[model samples]
Target: MGVQGLASFLDKHQNIYREVRFGRSRLLVDGCNLNYLLYFSSGLDQNHGGEYAAYVTLVESFIAALRSCDITPYVVLDGGSDVTDKKLETAAKRREDRIRKAHEAAASGRTMCILPRMAELVFIQTLARLQVPVAQCFAEADQEIAALASEWRCPVLSNDSDFFVFDLPGGFLPISHFHWREVRQSGSRSSVSCRRYYTSSFCSFFGLRRQLLPAFAALAGNDYVKLRGIDWTRFVQAGTGTEACGRLEGLLCWLKGLQESRGPLEVLEEALGLLGDLSGDKRELLQNLRLGMEEYQLGRSALSRFFLHGAPPEFPALEQEAGLVPGWMLLPVTQARLSGNVLDVLRLLRMNLGFGIETQELPSANQTSRPLRQVMYGLLLGKDRSSPVVEFDRAGLGPISVPVEPTFTRTSQRLRLDSLPQVALSDRLNVLLEALGVTQESLRLLPPQLQLPAAVSCYWLQTAQPPPDLQRALLLGMSNTPRSTAAFQNKSGIQKVDVDVSHAFSQWQACLKDAAQLNQLLGLPLPEPDVSRLYQGTLVHQLVHRMRSGGKLKTVLRSDRPSEELYRSLLSVVRRIRTRRTRQTRQKAATRRQQNPPEPSADLQRLFLQDEETESEARAAVAMQEELRLQEELLQVRTRYRTKERSNRSKNPDLARKEECRGRDLL
Candidate 1:
């Protein structure tokens, strides 16, 4: 977690950072931070679920830039939330903020830097494909990243404000200043020119001791320690637009007065004492402040041997704790094959922060994927499914955490978590199919990669509230297929996102993502998805428009026989599933109606007996419900045909005049 306003404060002082031609060095990349920076900065479509194909291209280009400069990069990612709950409040607060921002974005149609759920998967998979060295830490990767960077004596490239506080020997290269695209060449060698930050320079410029950086971070209110009631801005001699930045300056100025001879503990005590009227207990505040400072204290990198010798990092501390993570899963967890959400579900009986945007009057996109996650929880918790997993999700304009029961079908109920890996591949595959409610025979016709997407589409059609129709589903399927990567390249400008359509696809992607993870947990019973091939939102939405106007599917496939075949197979599977489900649903309803004949309610009977008008009103109400259902379906299409017509009329004065005369004649 970064210190609030620290990055901005350092950015103001140009002397704190030195211009350098960065090359021919080992770079320890903060994978999580870099993922956010790369996606948000690239101007990719965020509102329309995601533009994964474009995102994949961007990631490849970034890696290519580093390779061209001969920079050996080691990427580190955060695994799960800290089990200790030190940053629990901070994480929750940020989640709440994101939820609010997401609502605002949904309402205003403005981008809120919401990284699409599939973006992380795409990033990690792309790196794996490119043969980059990557590691996922057990907890927040900040300390681990700092530790590894310190040990390797390499610069950490990230835009996280937390990096400014760490005293990295090789220094910090902020992504904001990292002009990686502008590679400078001098005869035989090339380098990425950028600004580098050294903590020593920051401390010296502020006239404070290098040893006191941690103390400064603690006083300035990091995520771990936000000392309330103290008005730090009051001490500011000068102010900036951001109050937090001014407080940071004030804190540094105060630290400058402290004696260099004083130890860290002494300096911390002095800073805590500055909280004249402490909001909480003084002792507790002191403890938190100490913990905050301790976050920056690095040890010998735990990942060095893992990076050098390819041995997975051991978590003996976690292993000793009974029923934390199974010993078998430690390797996959480190390799980033399994989602860290599994750890959270197991450790705390709660899954934190399933991020997505919510639409008004529409069920949460997550609601559609709840059953899929429930099965995932079953695979994770196994025998321990008595207690439900509390899932944090966006509800309306606020964040809500609700307990979700783990679902164990007949097939998955027998699989034990500890021995899951030892189970036969067929049995594992059975569990995946059972969870998705599809048979192996159903998926056999499609490509292995398309199998999961097709299965997920079937589930989406069956379960999604206000379900997507055949044409939309076909468009989504085409967009997700690998062939579509080349068929529908990234377009130039942002297209207006259809919220209803976007939400439906978001639900589908969420289901696909969770199912893929469960499949990974079950040793990849289905082929691993190339996420880059799946769901380019911009292309998918464009295809939807084309399909709306009666465009031929062959044009999108570009007459590529293999692509056309894949599309047809995917469509056939979906159509068969939808048809079977509809028949089954109707049969079930017929059976239920036959078993329990509906009786008119006493009120309805009395109303019918009392007046004919009341009977007509009841009939009208029934008709209204049908009308509303039709309207909901119509709204999902969100066709812009009328808007386009109006635009054309506005552009051509003759067309507008002709339309006006035609309207008068019709009247």
Candidate 2:
């Protein structure tokens, strides 16, 4: 029947067959074969253009039908670029032969040139216009198509039965007239009956038990060779008959022997023995298989070694027990496909064999199923070496615990400001202020060095709330005399206290200005209330003064010799004012004594005698009081010396001696 007739017939009888729906079904087609048929067929006479239109229409119709059935089809094409040089030459010869035949036919006027060319154009145009998803392989179209189909687990549409040659596990069905026949037969009988007929027929004709179609084809050669008038019976006989069967038997026997061997060397010895028994083409095939297996086994050994110690052998042997090369040893795509198969086989084997059981030397049913592992084991055993048993240290996967002692617990060590000497603290504060870039203006009012005790005290007053005692002490020290204040109030000023307040306020304002300058120098951000600025400036001055003087008056109660010098300098300034006041008082007293010197009378003289006696007694009492004061002073000195000696014995004697010297110097 023509294509249209066939299509119409299939459409009419579509419901006759029981429909089977595939979950996530996809159809993979051989584009090259389809295109070739279309291009060569005279049925697609596209020279008149009408044939090309018809071809396009036919493809569209087919696509529409597929869409209606919700079947997605992926078409694959071959570019003929991947063909080997030898194959290319052969293809060229075949093409030439076809062209010559066409030319001869045209010359005879038996068949028109328009017919073949039109047919070719129609097929090409039809395929090009196909709306379905398509992929094209550079070379080895069959291999690419088979691989993709296997990967996607899609049904295949092809005239060649080679798709089954790969032995893909599931979801691949060959489409043909045979399928239509099966469908029709199923409708006439029961659905089950039709399925059984096709299934049994396929098994019996193809020997489907192991899906050994490839092996059969390898033995029988091509059926078309006979059609082309080539006598391939001898080749077929040599491949499938006594010799081929014997070779397979010998191979299986060798596999069994390798399984029994102690190591890979022994397996290799058995393989060589099997190799020695084969001859001619069969011998060559067996040798190739052996080499592929040896390479694969070597790859496995290397991988094992790598997993164990992060480095593999330079050249390990390949195992060839499965006839195919090891999946792990192949190039990416081939390796991916083979690895998938290997994993599946391994899973199935594992399901039956269980985990953690050693079956290295034995080729059980589990090993037979897992072709990859079987090959590896065989290579190792044949080569006379036992595969290392890798046992994972599961305990290494847990958290590590460290024992710690209570007495050795971690603690942060920080310097205690209270423990620092006033001079040392002052030096540290000066360093800290300098590091912070405190300005000279802020430091001008201070002594040369800054101390931590004064700095810390000033810092607390600035950042923290000032203590009541400290605030009271500061106010008391800053108090002005009432006379000076009153005199200023009467002399071109407001109230005397107001005058003092105004002067103090101006000083405070100057201090704030100094603070601002210091903030700029120290890279501190300006405060909104400017309290921080004021505090920092004051702190710098105080800390520096304390540091320079060697002892702070406010924080450190005890005064050392260096501190006494600072106190003495302040006292010297105050003493000048005190001395001037004392001199004025003496002058006033002298004038009073002179003015009130005498108003003497006779009765006063008589009274003076008795008064003189009372005066004498008063003088004696005053003398006795002075002696008692001296004795008390000596007793205090002696008591202080004894207490100090005891304290020195209890503490660091050297530190005590130094402190005593410092106290004596200050005194």
Candidate 3:
């Protein structure tokens, strides 16, 4: 997709990328890239609102995270997939494959990574609801982002390799590496922590001038132009760190050598002429170079401003609205007044998104469903504003003032969220695991039915493939494979797609064997994991003994003392198990008390009343909880009196409360 071998080439030959901080700067986001990011990250069935909510949350958090890092975000979405004919054909083929997968997923009733037809609209609507700045490009988002970044002097945030073709001065920061770390030895021989992949920096590192970038790309070939004719094996030989002046001529010499009769000059000219006219990888450098020029010429960045911020076309000729007015606006989540930590921000977002608010907003369950869009629209409208001052002096009217006018502000332009930090994509799923009170060790033992759902629900940008759930499920062992699945009908019957995980199981078993090789190498008396030394706590015991002896523990214990060591280790294990059970018993008692407060029997109560400290804490908790109960009763009385006062006010228009009532008491 990028210069064919650019990524690998840079990694092997030199350190091309450097980590740089861009605090308080604006990032131009590629919305199409983020849409796929969210789709793949979600695990809920498409039928569930939670799936949609996850998509919305990802976009919200992505912006929030950047803002938290002091970088403002401007989202730009693609208008259509129109592209060069060759690229369009490739995109069409991929789209067909995606369509087939979507059909299969629909039958199975699970989430798939296909971007829905409504995705672009849904994205725009979500951003509208969130009050974030967003733009829909007339063509590709890449062109818009590249052009905007260059003109605005900001970094384009994306993983798409083609941005390099824009030759922008402001540079590009790969979204995949927003918070990358680096390791390097210092002059004191210690690594100290310190960027973007600037086009200028990249060319500098490659020992090529900026102007030669097109030439370099042509030789490499790309999505639009492909290498053709020869294998290109041994081309641009590795470690050939020759000077810049020698590089091009060296390439010419290599090409001329390939053809005994042809002169170097003719070889170069012929290859350059026919490069982009065809498709396919070949050994000829000039063929690749020719295609590169064609691709470069097609770069669309020059027209970016027209799509992002050009003057509106004459209304009579305007067929559609093309751009969003640029600026940030506070979302309803901000009204929740959250401090923006991961959990708090997530809670606020869900509340505003209609997941949490509905239960609380309506007084009773018998009430009809409230359309979320209506509430969202009201929240998005924001507070009313007084009209701007008349300022007749500017028109030379001499102190003229107009009647008062009231207007409502629709959008807010804020650069930052609260001081609280946002969670990274890598750590976001860990929050869910923490809430569930599960650790990495329990992953392999999770039940089968819950495995896939849990795995999918937690899938994020950094989720590993062949998801751990599949591995965990395979570990629990398999059942008799279903020979045929029941057929189902929607408009037509759909066949079930059966998965064969036997190979995966075999692969896991092989992995287990490799791990067990340690035990086998030791030649212990115990088979597999049964050896006494395997779990022996002698190492720690010896260290403790040594400390007490003012020397060590290992010395007092003879090397042959396996029985004593085994006994100590087994005893330690027993203690750990008992402690785990005791903690679980206390947790259960606490949960029961929360569900239904009851005095426990002597034996049951003693389980949690383990020590003086615990008993004191329990007493404190009981005493403090009653304070809220009393406050609630007081609130009920206040509400009763207030309603009575309102009723009196409505009846006579003479009640003391009439002047102060915020809402009319007509009812």
Rank by TM-score, highest first.
1, 3, 2
Candidate with top lDDT is: 1
Error of 2 at 70 (Å): 1.2
Predictions in order: lDDT: 0.77, 0.32, 0.38
Q: TM-score for all predictions?
A: 0.85, 0.29, 0.39
User: Sort by lDDT, best first: what order?
Assistant: 1, 3, 2
TM accuracy, model 1: 0.85
- Give candidate 3 regions above 4 Å deviation: 8-14, 41-50, 81-86, 100-112, 116-119, 180-194, 238-667
Q: Write the per-residue lDDT of candidate 1 for residues 471-490, one digit (tens) a residue.
A: 45453545444554454544
**What tens digits encode model 2's per-residue C-alpha lDDT throughout 400-486?**
122111110011012211222222433333333432223233322223222211222232223221111232222212221223222
Task: List, residue by residue over 181-244, the lDDT tens digit for candidate 3.
Answer: 2323334332212246777776565445555456555555666565555434444554655333
Off by over 4 Å in 1: 233-245, 277-280, 316-320, 470-495, 549-554, 557-559, 586-667
Q: Clashing residue pairs, candidate 1?
A: none
